[model samples]
Target: MATSAVPSDNLPTYKLVVVGDGGVGKSALTIQFFQKIFVPDYDPTIEDSYLKHTEIDGQWAILDVLDTAGQEEFSAMREQYMRTGDGFLIVFSVTDKASFEHVDRFHQLILRVKDRG
Candidate 1:
């Protein structure tokens, strides 16, 4: 009798956050990564979570992805989300100047919320 060689159940899990200004393709990018589908339209996101299994260099890992709303009004809850993520993907459309400007702010906020210098 041969036991299974894959230890999928033992793989580590990571919490990832995708953040950017509104309409900056944050959701589309996340969905594409998890489902292999590209969404052509834009819809505002409040908050969304996704799970996906990925393998890299013969190692398996599970990802818990969080998609965040880009609107400034949701800024109040940003700290809470920041605290939960192990990593973040900050996105901004090359054509959108306003969105580009806010990237630094988001990065700063994440550091502050996570209490990292």
Candidate 2:
């Protein structure tokens, strides 16, 4: 027996921001998902580089992932992204524990910005 495809309920357009520290697979995931290429040993992203915009299923998106220095120390960079984004992916490497611990405060930052922009 076979079942038909389920239609997606109407959803508004979204602006997404992927946030994480350096060398935590954020760029790898973005390149793989959008560009459809995977370079296991690629170069790093400079502080300022324009990532390509892409469309999927009629929804327009620009994968503007952010890279902030001092992941171990607190910074205001993430709050800046959360201000304009409709959604986010806060990534941390499974192999690293320190990266995981720092995720908490960023969640709070997202909440605070949600009310503004």
Candidate 3:
């Protein structure tokens, strides 16, 4: 007799998407969160994924973190990421007023795409 392998029910998975304006440190923040190292330079992100297995409040889960591009040039790709994400980290440069403005736009778009109002 042949046996089938099934995924463990105890394993939980999560997708976290990082969104923000260019040069706002989105990649740096995501990297630092799991690696504890600070990146001192700026680089444009096309798309990047980082995986980490973690336990929170005694519950085990795997996090698939998606670091995304911050430029409007990549806006067309944002909705795809937004839809697949279980959660989002919206970011903006504190010292740059324009980035703050973009944050609002990003938030609205996420709400709209996720149909959350």
Evaluated with lDDT, which candidate comes out highest? Answer: 3
- TM-score of every candidate: 0.86, 0.62, 0.87
RMSD of each: 3.7, 6.3, 6.7
Error of 2 at 81 (Å): 1.4
Tens-digit lDDT track for model 3 on 5-117? 43346678899999998999999999899899999999899999998877645666788999999888998999999999999999888899999988888888999999952
Q: Predictions ranked by lDDT, top down?
A: 3, 1, 2
Clashing pairs in 1: none
Q: lDDT score of model 3?
A: 0.88
Which residue pairs overlap in candidate 3's backbone?
A: none
In angstroms, the error of model 1 at 100 is 0.7
lDDT of 3 at 72: 81
Deviation from native of the Cα of residue 82 in model 2, angstroms: 1.2
Clashes of 2: 0
TM-score for model 2? 0.62
Task: Write down the lDDT of every candidate, Cα atoms only.
Answer: 0.87, 0.61, 0.88
Cα lDDT tens digits for candidate 1, 16-117: 988889999999999898789999998899999998776645666888999999898998878888998999999999989988999998899889888852
Which of the numbered candidates is closest to the native, going by highest TM-score? 3
TM-score for candidate 3, please give it.
0.87
